[model samples]
Target chain A: MSTEQQTIDPLTPVLSADWGEKRSWTRAVYETGGGYDALRRALRDMTPEQVLTEVKESGLRGRGGAGFPTGMKWGFIPQENPNPKYLVVNADESEPGTCKDTPLMMASPHLLVEGVILAAYAINAHHAFIYVRGEILHVVRRLQQAVAEAYEAGYLGADILGSGYDLEIVVHAGAGAYICGEETALLDSLEGRRGQPRLRPPFPAVAGLYASPTVINNVESIASVPGIVRHGAEWFASMGTEKSKGYVLYSLSGHVREPGQFEAPLGITLRELIDMAGGIREGHELKFWTPGGSSTPILTAEHLDVPLDYEAVGAAGSMLGTRALQVFDETTSVVRAVLRWTEFYKHESCGKCTPCREGTWWLVQTLKRLEAGQGEEGDIEKLVDLCDNILGRSFCALGDGATSPITSAIQHFREEFEAGMHTPAWELFPYRASTVFAPEVTPA
Target chain B: MTQQSTGTPPISAEVRAELVEIGARYPQARSGLLPMLHLVQSVQGRVTAEGIEACAEVLGLSTAEVSGVATFYTMYKRRPVGDYHVGVCTNTLCAVMGGDEIFERLKDHLDVGNDETTEHVDGLKDITLEHVECNAACDYAPVVMVNWEFMDHQTPESAVQLVDDLRQGNEVRSTRGPRICTFRQAERVLAGFPDGLADEGPSAGIPSLNGLQLAQLNGWGPPPGRAGSDADRAEAVADQGRAAAQATAEDGQEGAVATEASPAGTKHEDAPGTGGEAK
Candidate 1:
């Protein structure tokens, strides 16, 4: 199951270049390190269409899971439309295993701020909003400070950098709904409604943010823009595979000895990343991992050499989503891991649509039973059947994603689930105690 | 507006003014619902009936609508909460790294389950414990957050000590930020207003900067394949290692000087967005 080490090229640190610098989040540090240079060049030298074309040529896909083309998403906004368009940066990094955006904002808030302005200019947006998750108060404060700094520096507000372009950036916070991470749901939340996903065909690009055409991009997707614009299309396109060009923040968390955000070109393999991460935690051996967050299907050590690009991961039956490589060692139980992820999905599932709202609730109950060794003989098939019903039938990707762990865990480790039917998870991993099942005691 | 509740008084004029300012941030006033709820939570311990009515009136929505939105999000507490809302992330990564054990121990120690507030006992009565989802700081696994500020890399012993300090009314501070505030103070900051403590602490931690540091130590580059010959790369790496070692030495010296200068460190300031001035 061991992957042969390949000669990985020296890592390309693009978005994360300034992350290690002292006081990196401050505007002074950012400006001194050549921040806002791209925004100036794009506004002064290039036309909006030219800026859009360069992004398209650069092949920067959406860093927020979906792998949608960044330029294409902006281009989807109709030029002929007289109504004003809005740009919303999805800073709600709530996916279970995804932790890159929060750190990115914490370390370099100005990078995201600068990127938002460039993105706004490209799409002819006068007002941009950064919808951050409410749970991270520190990050929210950092972003607010960054926006205020941008406004004070004339990078935001009317006629930025003496260019005719004007933009206003608002750093809005979401209460605590994971569904709001879904783009349309985010728009709905931004509009001050119940954070639920809207039906498509309007697709956000056509009608969004107060019924006006809007472009929604992830924090990383927008934050990666200043570099793309500053370095030119060919420069960004030169790295990574053809379809998935440019460097991305690969968040390597969990069992790895060094768990952090690794910014590398798109096509790098997990084997190379593991080597850079000081390999798996000392005595542990890699058992299973997720190429993306928990939403993507789990891949075992057998697939370690798979290039962590969109196409390669997709071909291998998972996605290169957000590149949240959550590695687990042999001591980890597949059933227990899936149950924890399922609990998260169940808790965070917005009761918007039936398949997700109802399906996720049922999944959690079934998973709890299976994990506690109270399942019947047909329970494994029942789990698969339940996943099958919810996979494509849900209103949004949440339901589909909720099924990924169950079906994939079963696909790769059916024996584990079968064993779960006989033995409780606590017996298998004695150290993995949880409060969820602890007996309730009266207060003394 | 819907019938006002007589039990709880209306939000203060300052809170109302702040709500109005927050409402104006959005093109539609309704968009300010979440932040307005946060403001309410900051004022009251949780989203009270009066708070819901105020939010509904501010946004011209029904009380039911406001309540629905408030209760939909986990951050907004429906019941009374402890002064410090301790949320230990028990998600997959953190759980495996003893977050589950930490949570179990805390539950037993406090005699309160998830989402339950402890009975008022001396100074610690306002403690609410919950197993929160990933706080997005998984690199420091088994993370515990007090009032939404990160308490990174927690073990059972450290986590127990944190709760003990909190309960004993000792000055408890976050690992990477200023002294930990009450949950209400943290909520105030979340409501689109800066607490002016933005410059208090290190923005990124060593674990956060680990990958980038490794890259620098290895002489990683922007261009993928053009990292020079092996001998040249090795020399660059050696140079980087020496520079890093020197920087660490200087930092150690500066750290001692800083400790001497600020023996007690700065105290936490309670500056809510009372003025509601738009930044």
Candidate 2:
């Protein structure tokens, strides 16, 4: 893995370092590779406060959608609260474009296991839960095994290596609900209720699980902690831009030559990552891509040079949400993509808030009309108006997300929408040509 | 057990014990309702009315509540599922990359619509075909999941062939995991029971490491992290802190293992290293 010393290597495979190793998820392979050393150092040497300080200093943002700073979130737990604290790792990664956490937990389950232990210790929580999505049975199996292995290894459970801290990790699986990815809905689902969002401000740190102080974090965010603790805060902060520190898994999929999880310093541009991925497949020009996952507004080829860090992406008018960059070429229809996403949001909406539930269904209907070339002249304006009503009006981000692709696609590809109105989307951009399975057709 | 059951429960004694065990694993008890529902499905295909009663009884909740929870999630089906449940990714990226085509082909071949199960033919295991949303496996776009095991990089032809193989009861394996198990058996694993298949297949797949493969091919590595003495400073501070703790407390090695070095542990210049433990 050594590179020329003169070059700042574009790829930094920290979380993914051992992903390719034989039997990487096993305790035998994991311990041999220093898997629990961070736990050793935390429990043996530093105080819990000190461990918390190192993380706060690292400036690690939540790898989940919102990008909230992890340490600050940990700090929010009221230490003096009488109720027992909890740490829940949100493993329900069902975002349309997000796949980083799945691969992370699949290949290196121990990383998340160790992170759970360390994070529990940092918050003084004796009990932690990993609420994984139930759809991926293998991931649940891998996690269950890893947790058992950690228990056997004494990295988890009471008094690890003679340290006087006790913790227990539970692997809970959620029934299929994308809304559970939303933190409060996750909390609700974890509580064995219908997964739905709750009103905020008693923010989880103040009162969560069973109405106690709690710390909920993403799988990647917690997994990154071992790296920060092993290598100093500066080591983590050294990688990315000032605001968005440390390395992240940039998932490059769709229309790319080699789509996969690219772990790099946060500020790396999509242009460079795409170049590293061997550029768009067969040199088809990049038409539009999601800077983050499907939730964040889509970016075009014009924004390829924008750094993928949170601040830069926000400055470029999109959040660095889960870093799920789904690329597409000109042969793809912007309208069709937006409609598929819209249908997804509608299907998965939890029906919690009125705007999201009703608005998404209506949006799907209107987009279907538009895509089928049966739209009225003012339908484009109506679509934007629907997006405006749905944005920020729902209980959670699902409604807001349903609006992103619609509003953004309209902004960038209005001509495509307008010109293609007399023609169906299948005629405007042949679905066959858009997909790789079909034979290649040269761009106009 | 105060009047938890209204009538004789229809599930087996062992299944009831598993349901109770799932409930006992949670601190709140009700939190185990989801997994209990899964266990119920594993035993009796779909969330049966009696299954809801059992879960409600186990968690001390009303059957109405349990039914509400079951109906809310997509996985908890009202209808009985086939022995094998095949899901094709039909979200945007996967759809654009031919998931739509694959799904259409499967529907035609299986003679079933979305979320519908094929009829048993001469004792063949029923196959339920559903077009699933983005399963977060878009890197291998147009991915399919048989009993929730990833079948990556699938084309329409391959998807049809896969369903056919499943119907024929041929031994099929996950693209990244073990031999394909029945949907009910898979649900047992989802209910937090190990199928002893953890070590069956490769932990990671090709698409999971495309960038790493290219980086290794190009001899690229991470930049020198935390330049100018972070390595030394952090260690010195840690050593100082350890010494201070050692001075106050009697240090006892409760569980000690022989220390040896592993290749994955060795730190490389200008790059992050994997964990090194006392093996």
Candidate 3:
């Protein structure tokens, strides 16, 4: 390792390093800051096998909620399958409190564009699709313009940069369906079908998108590719922990003083990130927070110093899924937060699986009763029972994620939920105090 | 988010041609169904039966199949939408952070329930108000979306004021920049068409660049001596590509921190005890 690699900064902004630069999204600014240099190098110097080997050596894990090894995922595409391989960048960043990708796409879409070219090259795929959610109109605009610019610059399309490597990137926009964020469902949605999860014996790598070998990586995961290409696997591997290599954007939101994206190396503690975020909105202490997005179970103040990597968070009863650290103070009620999240899960649950579709509704019903102080004697048990049925029985992670907040909240704050049997959540914690925007007092 | 249809409107020739164009972009014709449906919504203001039939005819899919796809996604409205679609984010994080209060205040101010439209009295602001799920803007919580543009960090008072400004035809802009447009125009953009306004706003807003700004402030960057930052910077300046298309991340306004980002629903931090937004 280089002597300089020993110095680790608390906040390492690689992907986000150019976010503050003026017009960083354009190919001009991006190239000025060494953008497509990775793509140019990849296409000119490396073979598909070589690129694959480099990625696998880097040990970069998926930035999407699932912590799968990204290069290993690229390696899974059966090259001899004869069917054309495909790469899909999942830019559908709709997870609650996970605001990293949308901003990344807005600020530096060429990062994702360059990564797409590099990934498509690595997997020997000519076609790539970036399925951005429809809600963010301007983000879609920035990405579309970036793709067009890449084509003009010869980084995309046939014969890229004097190399005979051919690639096509279609910036597909998704209709507002949280379920479509699921890889299988996103494939179905891409094919103009109802966005339901396909059964996974033939996973996406085997049979995805028109029944071909497809590699689907998250926006952040795919965007991190160019850096790996430009600087080699060892350089990419140098920043993060042993197993979980490289930097991640920790989206600290919800009651934090400076709620935003903190791109730090893997295994950085939430305690350090919170201090960088001006220490939990000034006065309030961290009551509970999610080490990742809302789907991975919530962590209490006890988990403040837990190293936020895949293995560390898993040992601490959570997964480093998306690194969306949603900080909640004591003014927020656990029961109320769990109920609202349960409502989201119920709303988003696709009806393909009976357990998730039916179970989420029942869990919400029980939680609502508890939140309103109208619970039955066994409502908490009933909520857990419903969660148990949905957890493993669902077709996808949607149903599974619905149970995380409810079960974790009950496990940590049983007293507050039990108090919900006779007293309302509003009585214990007034909702208004949790926000700075109180309605102006109207003169009667 | 269910929309009740009034009457089925047939798809126009132009819209049919555009649907066919969208269909051709995909390897499989049916794969273009989502964007085509979005295009139909842009034209008809909702996914009418005729719009579905047009899409089916273009892609050789059955009307039932197209309808199934249409109804599955929340964005494909079944009924007519207003000139603007005002969505209040009532998701978990946003809800506790005053989204519930904002949604309620807008509902009360406009005399509309969730997923309902305001009465078009003399064409002030005809709005379809709905409590939407998260739009991935939780950092700027209590986010209200006007047609898909983010009006971030909204309070009940500001949300109410925003609706009033819209009602009176004041030119309201997204917190990130970009003038507000009809939701139909937004759908058109989402259907793989650009409005040439990608250059309208700040690339990264506060909180988005919060970490980067803080790191720069503290002189923190990509580690002290990691991979080739020095070499890469030199190479970038040497071989910059496509000098013609110059677009800065910021146009006029930089993405500086707007508010101090204290919890909403309180007047001031130094106030004695927590201030109330008592109903």
Off by over 4 Å in 2: A1-7, A441-444, B1-9, B223-279
The better candidate by DockQ, 2 or 3, is: 3
* Model 3 backbone overlap count: 15
Better of 1 and 3 by DockQ: 3
TM-score of chain B of each: 0.77, 0.78, 0.80
Model 1: residues with Cα > 4 Å off, grouped in runs:
A1-9, A432-444, B1-10, B224-279
Better of 2 and 3 by TM-score: 3
**Worst 10-residue lDDT window, candidate 3 chain B:** B270-279
**Using alpha carbons, what is the TM-score of model 2?**
0.91
Could you tell me which 10 consecutive residues in candidate 2 chain A have the lowest summed lDDT?
A1-10
lDDT of 2: 0.83
Candidate 1 lDDT over residue span B34-82, tens digit each: 8998888777778999988888888788999888788778888878767
Model 2 chain B: ten consecutive residues of lowest lDDT: B253-262
Q: Pick the candidate with the highest DockQ.
A: 3
Which is superior by lDDT, 1 or 3? 3
DockQ of each: 0.30, 0.33, 0.34
Per-residue lDDT of model 3, residues A1-444, tens digit only:
242536766777778877665566788778887678777667766898888888889898999989899989998899899999999999988888788999999988999999999899989999999999999988999999999999999888889998998999999999888999999999999998888999998999999988999999999999888887776677678788878998889998888778889988898998998888887775677799987778989999899888898999999887788888888988899989998888888898889999998998898888888888888898989888888998888999999898898888889999999999998998898899777564433334
- Model 2 Cα shift for residue A325 (angstroms): 0.5
Name the regions of candidate 3 deviating beyond 4 angstroms: A1-5, A438-444, B1-10, B224-227, B230-251, B254-279
